[model samples]
Target: MEGQRSKVSSCSFVSYCFLFWVQLLPLATGGKVPALIVFGDSSVDAGNNNFIPTVARSNFEPYGRDFQGGKPTGRFSNGRVPTDFLSEAFRIKPYIPAYLDPKYNISDFATGVTFASAATGYDNATSEVLSVIPLWKQLEFYKTYQKNLRAYQGETTAKGTISEALHIMSLGTNDFLENYYTSPGRSTEYTPQQYEDFLVGIAGNFIRKLYGLGARKISLGGLPPMGCLPLERTTNVVGGNECVSRYNDVALEFNGKLKKLTTSLNKELPGIRLVFSNPYYSLMHIIRNPAEYGFDSTSVACCATGMFEMGYACSRGGMFSCSDASKYVFWDSFHPSEKTNGIIAAHLVKTALAQFLE
Candidate 1:
């Protein structure tokens, strides 16, 4: 009888410790954020473009030169992107793999995965321009991921992982830069304001769909200072190295609408934690004051001549490529350097991410 009583006490003690650990998890880490699920453009893309036939790909030398093993992994930057840093910040994992990568199976995805494709946007036309995966197709891939995850980890674990994961969407830049501004179709179809509204409408619906798919925590990234990009400054502001104020104004306006959309979504959807992550101010600050951010050049990228080179153009054979990428604000004409991405990620974790946890 005494032995049975001792066994019962031991079982009760083990149960108590398990409950205590579960309760301390949120406090020990940031929150109950289990995994980081990402969607959208090159800004957050892991390596989804590598599997697709697209000119927007950066899966070669000098791209991931600073990454582990100094080998390119299809990340646009010289190293890790913002999502990677965020994954580390949440204490989830060191790197978030691309969902389409054959190396990672359902078990790997049950932790975190990115459906983002370089050059893709909320507008399907933007993706068509470069033959990349459209937002809808990404959603389809996500559904498949869900099915596979359920099969591998059982329905309860899969459901909990999906619902507790932190979903991040970083798009819109490609829609404006690649589709609306560069391409004639969208510009002729709608004015800038109308285009902003159009994009926001799509974004709203996407968020709703994600919520329906069991995502409770979502972060939608707003547009950066597009005019400040090395490519934009080189092409838009002729004969000079000044940011195009007109383009910056458009980004600010779009961000305002996106912020409003997040607020509205939070109110409309019950039990949903939706927040807007504005990278504009942070990136602009880094550009305006490069020295403050330990950067030497803000006007041009570290790739080649830093005037007009990206993707295939920014190769290892390219002349005058900066030896130290940490000194440059941009790794390529169109994308921020890995260092810049890290800084922005840190800021988002402190501000926008805090709200999600709360």
Candidate 2:
């Protein structure tokens, strides 16, 4: 694959973007959405990790060279993330602001904001490993955001905004990666099936909490083909060019159960539109046949070593980055490139979110 090279970018963390179309550009979509409120991990985190007391932040070079101003914004991708694209799709704003960002005033909260923290997960132990925000803590931040919204916009308008906003969750990946697989404690305590059930329960509880917070339109992203990630490929026991089937088995099991959980929640929780967005289908679709999707490499990343380096390791002054990042599916060992995120977001909007659109 073209991603095996170890060259890197030479720019600083504060490069001014010459292109206006990167952030101000309007993306096309059929659905009319008011706002996008996002939660979960690095996948959807705009800059929540930057404010957090955690080293899991991506506020460094090469992290956002493709972003609005070509400056790092604490997103782990090569550029704009899924929520940014989803915001564009909804015509809410070019980028969803982080609630913790003091620079943006209350008017910025008119459209929804992101409460996601990079490296966070359903399990407290998962976030403990990385010293980032946990699921429960993220919920607390959501509560604070809601309180601010009510203060910023009168109670009635805030209530309507909370009910009408498109809420999205990109969680659970770290619960597996950082907890089940990496943590020796979890494996010793529970089997694979037991762990899956535990995480599903956590997810269910979180969704219920969101419903209680007046979130009506909720879309949760299921686990991707975790085995196919470059990091997983390198770490998987069944090594070679093939993906780790056992890891994917874990993800598949989780996705099926997660879908069932959402279905049950939708049936029981009256007036809540819960959707299980299975990213596995879209991710694997590109992996199995990269050429059709215009991707040149699916097994390797565009930054650093491509197989195992990311975040600080993928910085501009560190290792080599691909000349054409769009050709690769992954921006780093764990995160997808902006192109791949756009593709998956577009697919989800059309297939998953479109169905529930009013």
Candidate 3:
């Protein structure tokens, strides 16, 4: 009778163990991890150009010296972009493939998302200026992706996937940089403030579109301190060793307006998550207190020219290049270094992701 009792107790213990393991499975294997659907410009482009014919390509030398493989991975940054670190903090994966990449691993799309088009912006004219993928094209990609996802995971599952995922957007800088600043067409139509308003309208439209497509958690990035970037500092502006405050003012104004708009949007759409990552604040803080951020050369870039030129303009054979990249904040004329990306990613994780993901 004692043996029989012992056998029953063992069976009960085994059942408990099985249940415990079942409960721990998701946490153990990181099961059904929330997806990170990204959409933006070069600042967030994760090797999208590898599949495009755009001249905005960055899969070349001195682009990824700080990356794990020490080779260009088509990221506009010197190493990893903000999305890379954000994905890491989320514990999804390292690299998020561009939806357009011919080699894109579809299986991973279940856990990750990328619609960022390099050199793209809210304005249609911006794409023409850069001869790169446009925001409209990116949206089209998303539309097609929604179909593919439904096919892959079924309708109910796909809707749930999109609803649960975090939709990240970091655009508008290019609209200002390439169009409002340089292009004849946009400049003729709108002043700086007018252009800002127009772009914000586009941003709002984009958000609404995402909501229509079943996205709930949306993280829209505010423009960085554009005045401080090497590109803005060097190009066209006169007698400015320092950054142009006009650009910074525009960023501040746009971000402020967007914040207010988001509040209203939340009330309009209940149970929706709308987060804005203020890259303006984070980038401005580092620019103002470069030493504190561990960057001695905040004004200069590590690439050629080391001061103003960025993207294709920052070429080694054409101009000068710096030795150590760690000292500088700007990787080229436009984007942040991998270290800065890490810093920005850390803050974003806490602010934009922690609560949303939870």
Global lDDT of each candidate: 0.84, 0.80, 0.75
Segments of candidate 3 deviating more than 4 angstroms: 1-33, 236-238, 315-320
Candidate 3 residues 151-199, lDDT tens each?
9999998889899888898898888767787678888888878888888
Estimate the TM-score of every prediction.
Answer: 0.91, 0.90, 0.87
Q: What is the lDDT of residue 331 in candidate 3?
A: 80
Candidate 1 overall Cα lDDT vs. reference?
A: 0.84
Clashing pairs in 2: 7-320, 7-321, 8-319, 8-320, 8-321
TM-score for candidate 1, residues paired by index: 0.91
The best candidate in terms of lDDT: 1
Better of 1 and 2 by TM-score: 1
Clash counts per candidate, in order, are 0, 5, 0
Q: Model 3, 152: alpha-carbon shift in Å?
A: 1.8
Model 3 lDDT, residue 85, Cα: 68
Per-residue lDDT of 1-358 in model 1, one digit per residue for the tens?
0011000111122223333433443565654778899998999898999998888888887788777767789999888888987787777776799988999987788878999999999999999999999999999999999999889889998899888899999998999988998999999989999999999999999999999999999999999999888888888646486887878899999999999999999999999989999999999999989998678999888888776788999884345577777778898999998888888887787788876554
The model with the greater lDDT, 1 or 2, is: 1
Model 2, span 22-130: residue lDDT tens: 3343344323457788888999988888887888988887688777666788888877788887786676676788867777766886786888888988888898988
The regions of model 1 sitting more than 4 angstroms off are 1-27, 237-239, 316-319
